[model samples]
Target: MKSSRIQSFAAGVLIANSAPHLATAVTGRQHLTPLAGRGSGPKVNAVWAALNLVGGTLLLRASRRGGTERWDGDLIAFETGCLAFASWMAGSERWLRTNTARQE
Candidate 1:
């Protein structure tokens, strides 16, 4: 159960992380990614997004094998992870924009 919850949470984080990169990639824009850091271009971001999406899916499916004994707990943990990552992303993006504006 604990392992499953952890997997679920991690899966949520990875899945959430993929969305922004995927959206950026589709727009043919560059985005910072762990794989290529600040130099990540659209193609690189696309590949990074794919990797994260697939990895998260695999983790989520695996975690589900534990059954629904604690479904609610798992769901909450997963939601927390998703929300946490999303909030962090939004905050960081805003901070970066502000700092960049100041620099220019």
Candidate 2:
């Protein structure tokens, strides 16, 4: 794929990755992210989320047609896959922490 396509795909993944952090930040809840370590703080998550959103938007805008037009299936799938993988990893890490804490 071309660089524009790759950027578009990355933008999708970044936005997907930002969702939970953004939601938690807006709702004044804590979330686990790499920056947050385990449970840093709502504000921290918010900052991280905002950064993600900015980066994603920038990438999308740099893509073909400035990401305003509709995207193709392959690109969407690639983005979705990235999102799913990242989300799963985050959730799995949280789950492991919870289980470990429970056992302790």
Candidate 3:
């Protein structure tokens, strides 16, 4: 049990550290762009929005299965993060659309 707890702790730490890279990868893939290449902001934002929705769903499911009473904080954080990402994506898309309209 102790070893398992330690492993779980390590896993969490690793996940936290790797989140930025994962986010970038997901953003890139959603935009259909190379990881090292520049992608349209709107496209990336849309991808992020989609990913956040999906991630939020998954997190909620996990929370439910794990018993939310025990991990309420994590669940709340996940939900908040998803909302933040989605909102940012929406803003990005709106900005891009407006910019394009201006150019036209």
Candidate 4:
């Protein structure tokens, strides 16, 4: 049960991480994704998004294995927590760098 819950939570994190990058890629925008290096562009972002989708799908499948068929509160909480942290970090990195650059 505990292992299943952990896998489910991990799946949630990957799914959440995938969504924004996919959206940005589909929209043909160059947004800051995890894989986007300093020279990020539309094509790079799109590739990054594809990787996220693949990873998320794999984790989702893994979560479904080992007799885990339903969602649990702990699973949900862990997923949500990871998603929120990822979002915050992604959103803040650029702003932080820009602000610090100006201050220098």
> CA lDDT of each candidate?
0.85, 0.71, 0.44, 0.63
Per-residue C-alpha lDDT of model 4 across residues 1-104, encoded as one tens digit per residue = 66656665676676666665667667765566556555456677677767766776676566667553565564674577467757776677666762122454
Write the candidate numbers in order of decreasing lDDT.
1, 2, 4, 3
Candidate 2: where is the Cα deviation over 4 Å? 65-70, 73-104
Q: What is the C-alpha lDDT profile of model 2 across 1-104, one tens digit per residue? A: 46776776788777776777788788877667778575757898888888888988897777755344567753675577477757775787677653133454
What TM-score does prediction 3 earn?
Answer: 0.35
TM-score of each: 0.86, 0.67, 0.35, 0.64
Candidate 2: worst-modelled 10 consecutive residues by lDDT = 95-104
Better of 1 and 3 by lDDT: 1
Q: Which rank order by TM-score, best down to worst?
A: 1, 2, 4, 3
In candidate 3, how many Å is residue 37 off?
3.4
- Per-candidate clashes come to 0, 0, 0, 0
**Residue runs of model 1 more than 4 Å from their true location after superposition:** 98-103
- Can you tell me which runs of candidate 4 are displaced by over 4 Å? 34-36, 73-82, 90-104
lDDT (tens digit, per residue) of candidate 1 on 10-76: 9999999999889879998778888887768899999999999999999888998948766778888
Best by lDDT: 1
Angstrom error of the Cα, residue 2, model 2: value is 1.5
